[model samples]
Target: MDPRLFLADLEAKPAALRNLASILTVGDAWAGLPAPVDRVLLLGMGSSRYAAEMAALRLRAAGLDAVAEYASTDASWPPGPRTLVVAISASGTSQETLDAASGYAGSAPLVALTNVPDSPLARVADLVVPMHGGTEEGGVACRTFQHTLVLLLDLAARLSGEPRDVASLARRAADATEDLLARRDEWLPTVADLLDGRHGVYTLAPAERLSSALQSALMVREGPRRPAAGCETGDWSHVDVYLTRTLDYRALLLPGSRYDRPALDWLRSRAATVVAVGADVAEAAAVVRYPGDDDPYVRLLTETLVAELVAARWWAAAF
Candidate 1:
C-alpha cells in the first residue's frame, strides 16, 4: 500500500469539512418532533456509530433526551412515534442501517446523513445531509468520519438554537493537522516504535474521549490488519482487565478526564505497552502530544489525525 494515499485522504479532512458547511443547512429536518422533544434516537454502524454517539452526547448536553444505538441492534428501534430517528451511514450501503431505516418507514419522518448523497438511505430519507468529504478510495472512512461528526454537531447546534460557524472551526482543524504532519519527525518515531513490536492494540479513554479512541482503534485495525479494541475506561477495569493479566497488550489512552488515571495505572502495572495522547504520563511508553486548549471538540480533529498517522506508521512497518 502506498501510504501517501491514506495520509492524503486523512489530510483532506479540513477542506472536506469546509465543503460540508457550504452544502448543508438544517431544514425542517426536525419537523417531526414536538415543540419540546423529550427524546431522540440515532442509529449507525461502525465509525458512523461513533459519530452518532458523540452527537447524542452533544444533544443530551443541550437538554434533549438523546441516545445513540448501533443500527444492527434490535433494541435501537424508536420507543414511539414521538422520538426522532436519525439514521447515519457513510456508505449508505450498510445493510444494517438500511434495514433499520426500512423498519421505521412511517413511524416518524426519518433524517439521513451520509457521504454519498444518492445512497439508498438518502433516497428514502425525509431530509438528506451530505458529508461532502469527497471520494475516499483508501478503503477507510478518514475524512468521511470527521465530516460526519461535524454535520451531526452542526445539526445539534441548530436544534439547540446556537448554531456555530463550522467553516471557521474546520479551517482551524486543517491548520492543526497540517502542523502535525509537517513536524512528524518529533513524535512519530517514538510512538511507532512502541507499536511495532506489539501483538495487537487496545485503546481506552474516558467516556468523554471514547470517540477518538474508537476512531483510533478503527484506523489501527483497518490500516494495519491488526486486532484492535476500544473500551470505556472504568468499565474495562471491571470486566476486561483480566485480559491485561493474560496478555501483554499495547494500549492507547485518549486522556481527557482525571478518572482515566486508575485504569492507566492498572494497565501500566500489568506490563502493558501504554501510549497516551493529549497528555504526558510518566508511566506510558510514549506520549503523543496534542494541543492543550480546553476545548475538546477542536482537539478531536487534531488528536484523531494523530491516530491516522499511527495507523499509517503501522502500515509502513508491517508492509
Candidate 2:
C-alpha cells in the first residue's frame, strides 16, 4: 500500500461523504431486500465485520433478532426463508465472505454490500447494494469503512422501523471530518507525540461505538505496521489495565462511555499518557476536537480520522 495514496484517500473523505449523503437522499439502495425479515445475519471479515457487529448491536437494541458473525466461522445460524444474510466486502471479493454467503445461497435472502458492483460477491447475492465510497487508491479501506457504517445505520433504521435522518447524519459527519482535516496542523503533531510510545498504541471506545476503536487500531497496524490493540471502555479495567502498570502505556480514548471514568482513573494512577478524541477529558495529555462532535453519530463516523491521519503520517515517514 502506498502511504502517499493513503493520505490522499483520507483527504478525499469529506467529499466522498457528501456524495454518499446526496445519493442517499435521492433513493434507498436497500429497496431490493425482501420485507418481513424475521432474522438478520450479517457476514463479513476484518473491517467489514467490525462495522457489521456494530450494526447488529443497534438492530438488537431495536428489538430485532440480529447477529454479525465472522465469515471464517465454520458454523452459523441456519439459512431460512425469513433470514436475511448481508455479506459485506468493500472490494466484493473477500473469499471467506463469499464462501460463507454461498452456504445460504438459495435457502435465505442474500444481499451483497460492496463497492464494486461487478465483483464476485455481487454475483452471489439476490440483491447488490453499492458502497458508493468510490475507489481507495491507497489500497486500504478508509472511506469504504466509513461508508459501511453509515449505510449500516440506514439498514438498522429500516429494519427497526426507526425514523432517523441518516442522510443528515452523513452530512454532519462530513462536516466534522472536514473540520479535522483543516485543523490537523494544529493537533496532529501533538497527538502523534503523545501516542508515539515504544510499547504500542491502544484505542478505547464505548461499546456503542466500538468500531471506532477497532478501525483506529487496525489503521495503525495496517498502515504503519505498528502494534496496536482496541478495547471497550468498560472492559479496559479488566483486560488492558495491567499494561499501564509496566509499559509506558499510551492510548487514544474516544470518550462518551459512562464507564470512562474508571478506565481514566487507572490511567491516571499509572501515569499513562492519553489522547482524547472527539471530547475533552481532563486526564488526557491532549484533546482533539472537531465540528459536530457533540453528536454521537458524528463521533462514530468521524473520530477515526485522528488515528488514520497519525497512521498516515508515520507510514509516510517510513517511506
Evaluate all candidate structures by whole-model CA lDDT and list the values in order: 0.76, 0.96
Compare the candidates by TM-score and give the number of the best one: 2
lDDT for each residue of candidate 1 in 1-319, tens digit (9 for 90 to 100): 4566787787676566656555543443234344445577889999999988888888888888888988898865454656777889988989999888878767766778887889999888766777778888677888888887777777787777776766566666666666677778898888877865446778777676678778988898889878887887887788668888877677877777666778877887888888887777788888776443345777765677776888887786767
lDDT of 2 by residue, 1-319 (tens): 9999999999999999999999999999699889889999999999999999999999999999999999999999999999999999999999999999999998999999999999999998999999999999999999999999999999999999999999999999999999999999999999998999999899999999999999999999999999999999999999989999899899999999999999999999999999999888999899999888998999999999999999999999997
What residue pairs clash in candidate 1, if any at all?
none
Candidate 2's error at 228, in angstroms?
0.3
Best by lDDT: 2
